[model samples]
Target chain A: MIIANTLADGFVVFLTEAHSWTNDITKGAVAETDEQAESLLTAAKQAEQTNVVIDPYLIPINIEDGLRKPTEYREYIRATGPTVPIPS
Target chain B: MYRYDEFDARLVTERVEQFRRQAQRRLSGELTEDQFKPLRLMNGLYLQLHAYMMRINIPYGALSSKQMRQLAHIARTYDKGYGHFTTRQNIQYNWIQLKNVPDALADLAAVEMHGIQSSGNCIRNTTSDQYAGVARDELEDPRVYCEIIRQWSTLHPEFSFLPRKFKIAVTGSPNDRAAVKLHDIGLRMHQNEQGKTGFEVIVGGGQGRTPFVGKTIRDWLAPEHLLSYLEAILRVYNLDGRRDNKYKARIKILVHQIGTDEFRRLVDTEWQQIKDGALNLPQSEIDRINAYFTPPAYAQIDDETESLNEQRTQNPAFDAWVQANLAEHKVSGYSIVNISLKSPKLPPGDVTAVQMDALADLADEYSFSELRVNHRQNLVLADVPQKDLLSLWTKLIELDLATPNIGLISDIIACPGLDYCALANARSIPLAQEIHQRFQDIDKVHDIGELTINISGCMNACGHHHVGHIGILGVDKRGKEFYQFTLGGSSDQNASLGDRTGKGFPADEAVNAVEKILNTYIMVRNDGERFLETYRRVGMKPFKEALYGSA
Candidate 1:
């Protein structure tokens, strides 16, 4: 799973699976449980109007994935903070 | 020195015309910013923060005085009368107007130089040793192979829209001054046990967010298989390199994920398919390209050791300059002189139009009408005669080019950073200036000995911080600037990526930290050792202890 949030016009937050490629249980259809992933998938699909097709299985899993129970094989985005920041 | 024959000339001219049309269309608002962005990038016109930036190729870092003068002319006429030489051995004009880009292309094309493939996700300018032909330890002139690759890769159709940008560097010299190890693909010209000259190909070495030293994929790749092998690598990267994430788009990440052995196997399979294809590089074409880089005719002269010794004894400054700037040349009575662009108070690698013209004049007068833009961002007069050393040094000093700090602590490699580059997170130039000011004392710098302190504005590694003996990477902490330091890195033959020396430091404290580190090295060094030698012997422990001190 890969998710990106547009902080600025040029700046984007890219998220991917920590260990391996994500499984697309929903296939071409959207997951009914999430709104953020659906919106991102729509945007991504629009962006891929040209011949260069974005892999449909590799949908953005932002809201659902974050809300789900954390696991060892979970996704990790290079967020704008230390992975383990020491307390000042 | 690779003169464009009819085919090359036609292609370049056509490219200029094509860019001219594109520029005209964009000006007429026929193309939007998004639409025109790729087109301009294809022509090497980048929309930087302030203005349009133009990157001009210095094919394999080799340039004639005529071509250099053209660059100088571009700087004076089209830009802000200064040019920034990049780590990739290309020069960037930061203040180019979109209206004048077409004219700039035509001007560059007039000198057999074009910005083609300088940007875009295509094969870029093939860089080699600045002293490629003239270096003493070179197996052969690497420029010959560079030129050949240039021809093969120029506007290569299939590989144009790869996963991301691809860079290839070749080095004939044993020293590896070209930083071949840090490139997407590095080719070191070598002779196998059979005494047959070929390349030792290393793949997937790059430094951005993820820094990796390229692994040797092929111990020996014959000259004939160069293009085919490169195609294979590109094909593998193009097919499998991550396209979803821009950060993970580099071949290095792909190679890392796939593992070197698996990647090599895939490349080998690809190579088996494409080997001895049309891109096999015909013998006649090779000969044609080789002809351009043929060594200039020289009048045999005895080494002026006695006179040089007399001058060295008389002038301490000259002696220091000679020690730092002079490089051993293939010819006995000649030497390559590095005119340091990293003068104190001046932005590192910022050469003014006047300096460029002066270097052009010096190149014509002192060298065989040749100048080289080194990977260190210094200009080189590769064939300066032994007798003219004093006079040349005097002239260079007058032009503020004789810093006598080449390969010293003050001789820093710095990118424009936030000062000029839009992508930069923090200001690298100011940091470099601060460091340069700190080490302006010549005596202290000399005592510190041969050290390369490379600074990059961002993790793009445009300044090649990963390979620096003391690497400083600028990072943005919130709105404030912070710098991360790395130790014990080298770009030479035994190339290795630097180890991160703990946490990042604030911009103001970075130089002080560096000073502390250097002071520790000076104290602990065994028997007049260089900075790298000491760092190697002691590892990072002593330096870390000195820097942090039981924090």
Candidate 2:
């Protein structure tokens, strides 16, 4: 799965729904194969041109119970956001 | 306290205008990321893990209450209502909008501040002793020289691009609070045989993947020739420093490759040309900048040490705070109050907008209208009167900042880690929070005594883990978070690097590993001995044995 932060305000973004960036990963497509992941990255690279998200890249992940999750702890933190509140 | 002149004002305004245009261009796709990266970096706007992190340079870590209020305003208006004070004496807003940066910088400029040259491959904001003028042990106020260097290095046409970013730190006292020895260029003020103040010029000291304590390039450089000498060193570095690899681009690599003696010869050769040339700082300009940093109008008040002692005896919390946080001021009646940003739960160095406003108010009411940002990511109310210590402590308590864990084990130094930084390999903040939580009792923490536990998300050393007595560097093993510990590091006058523990602990065992080391210290330490002192005396054998459990 390709995960990134939006350039405008820095929220979590996932490549979802035909290569569009969205916050919801459940609605997103996961790479079924390495070839598909490569193709997804090629499609996602265009998001930088739109200047919406910066440095989009693939991460190790596991999909279970129809929900996607990052395989790594750092990726999990980035995907879910900081454990602490934003302090309003 | 050095107010911007008309030229400075004009320069800041023009830079803001230019960055505004560049921001617009980037948004509209007129500029690509490759073209726009340097421009944005020069303005201190960075794309971090979650958002755009805008680093605001607080020159010499000096800020007036008005400037602090402006920072609070910017945090409230443009960012996530708080800012993280960095280890380099700057505050970073982690959640900034790319479009809002120009406006935020415009607000900063209204307070005579700009982010120029803060993040680019240029000389960054010249950091110095937080208690520059007021330290009892100071030979000179390093801020005067800091301002001099700031003016000399700011927007220098020749140094706009270099091999990599350069950092300089200066100190005026024998007690090295500024960690001057761990910078690209470090200047330590001292008196020569004739009782004239100059600097012991040290170069090539840095902490990163390759860590080295700066070597003394010049034993004594005359005060008048400061700028010329610095320009000479930089000129040599600019021409000769490596550029082939980004990892090896720092001037430290150059100094290491050529050796300090050869590097000194080159700097000296360059210096002879500019020694009496236009770069020689004029006496009037030096005096003009120095005048801004003279001792504030101190009242004829007694030290009141007896009463402060009495108050400490009465209130245990205040006493713990007084013991840990307060430093003796040059003026007898005043005390340097170090406000700890390392609360037990929150991330170290994070301060909220409301807290900033409150600190500004505290500065105005208790201390003078000035508060200093220490390079340890704490704030200093430098001139608080001895009599007002209790009241200040009370106020801090109300603000949830009176943790009284200043030099204690709980007062951790951790970077933003994977939570915020794009470059981090593993999580640092969560590890730090775990450590802080593990060691919570103030009495127990105080008994542990004066252990600097620094954690960096990666080997970049943003958390200054290289100099920590107990340094923790987070690492990744097959996408799993692990931590590596180091021992016997000190950033004081006796600057030294830490030695790695030879093993890595998975995230679950990281805090337990630290606990084992600390337990070993408690077991083997002499009376009133700090962790570093014990580690230095005994060497690492016992601690290694404790962690790894024998051969």
* iRMS, all models: 13.7, 2.0
Every candidate's lDDT: 0.80, 0.89
Chain A TM-scores in order? 0.28, 0.85
Per-residue CA lDDT of model 1 for B154-227, tens digit only, reads 88889899888999999987788888888999999889999998999998888888998899999998888889
Best by TM-score: 2
At residue B514, give the lDDT of candidate 2: 93
Instruction: Go through the candidates in order and give the C-alpha RMSD of each one to the true structure.
Output: 10.8, 1.6
DockQ of model 2, rounded to 2 decimals: 0.60
Model 2, span B164-227: residue lDDT tens:
8999999999999999999999999999999988899999999999999999999999878998
Candidate 2 versus the native: TM-score?
0.97
